[model samples]
Target: DVKVTQSSRYLVKRTGEKVFLECVQDMDHENMFWYRQDPGLGLRLIYFSYDVKMKEKGDIPEGYSVSREKKERFSLILESASTNQTSMYLCASSLYSGRRYEQYFGPGTRLTVT
Candidate 1:
């Protein structure tokens, strides 16, 4: 089975503190995405990478960034985190081409910024 592991399941930080959320997938997929989920805003895409060192900004990329140094690992960075940034972070991996290109999501990292 394909597995996605995150560095932390929960995190708490003060406002203005920098945060890093790590994710790794074992499926050797070409596409990786980072999304933040809030109450009413739904799941908003933060960033996505199609290939190593290649990234694209999503709908809500204001205070977020991403890194894809390797094929299996993708990192999400929150520069100067704030209370508004507190939410559940999800990392998903998917193949770029297939009959079903559905994304497989990780367990998610709940971040609370106070």
Candidate 2:
């Protein structure tokens, strides 16, 4: 069974504090993505990594960064947490099959920044 697990299901952080969100996939997918889900904004991509140690900036990567040092793990880092950054973070992994790919998403991490 393919599974993606997040480090925390819920997190609370103070403004300006650094936060780390960890995600691990047992399927050994090559493509990993970090997305933030808001009330109306839906899912906005924050970052993605296609290969180990290779990262790419997504649609909204200004205040966030990602690390994929290992093939099965991906970490999303919030440089400085802010109230506006509070949202449900989702981690997904997919194969490199062009045009037809299905992403397996984690349960998600709901972060609240105060």
Candidate 3:
């Protein structure tokens, strides 16, 4: 089974602190992504990595960065956590080439920046 594990199910931070969220996928998928889900807005991609050490910026990569030094591990770094950044962060994984390449999501991390 495709499994993605997130570092935290919930997180609380101050207005301007650096936060790091980690995700790991056991399926060895070539594509991994980080997204944030808000109330009105659907899931917006923060960043994605197609391969190890290769990354792509998604729609909202303004205050975030990512690292994919290992094939199974991807990390999302929030340069400065803010109240506006409080949202549900989801990590997903999918195969690079497949017929039905639907992303498998993690449980998600609910971050509250106070």
Candidate 4:
């Protein structure tokens, strides 16, 4: 079975603070993603990395950045946290087959930016 783990289950940070959210996958999947879940907007993609040192901006990447230095690790960086950014952040991993790939998700990190 594939396993994905997030660095924190809950995080509280003040406005303008730099925050780091970490995710790790054991399956060595080729694609990794970061998303933010909100009540109305649902799941919105933040960033994704298809390979080591490669990154792409997702639907919402205005204030976030991502890093994939190693195959097993992916990190999401919030340059400046804001109250509007408070949400449940999810990390997912999947192998990119020709067809639709099944993504395995982590438990998520609930971020509260005050």
Q: TM-scores for all candidates?
A: 0.96, 0.96, 0.97, 0.96
Error of 3 at 56 (Å): 0.4
The sequence of per-residue lDDT tens digits that candidate 4 reaches over residues 3-88 is 99999999999999999999999997999999999998889999999999999999999999988999999999999999999999
**Residue 5 deviation, candidate 2, in Å?**
0.4
Model 2 segments more than 4 A misplaced: 97-100
Ranking by lDDT: 3, 4, 2, 1
lDDT of every model, 2 decimals = 0.94, 0.95, 0.95, 0.95
TM-score of 4: 0.96
Clashes, model 4: 0
**Least accurate 10 contiguous residues by lDDT in model 1:** 94-103
Candidate 4: give the clashing pairs: none
RMSD to truth, every model: 0.8, 1.2, 0.8, 1.0
Lowest lDDT sum, 10 consecutive residues, model 4, at 94-103
2 or 3, greater by TM-score: 3
Candidate 2: RMSD to truth: 1.2
44-91 per-residue lDDT for model 1 (tens digits): 999999999999999999998888999999999998999999899999
Task: Give the per-residue lDDT digits (tens) of candidate 3, residues 14-65.
Answer: 9889999999999889999999999999999999999999999999999999
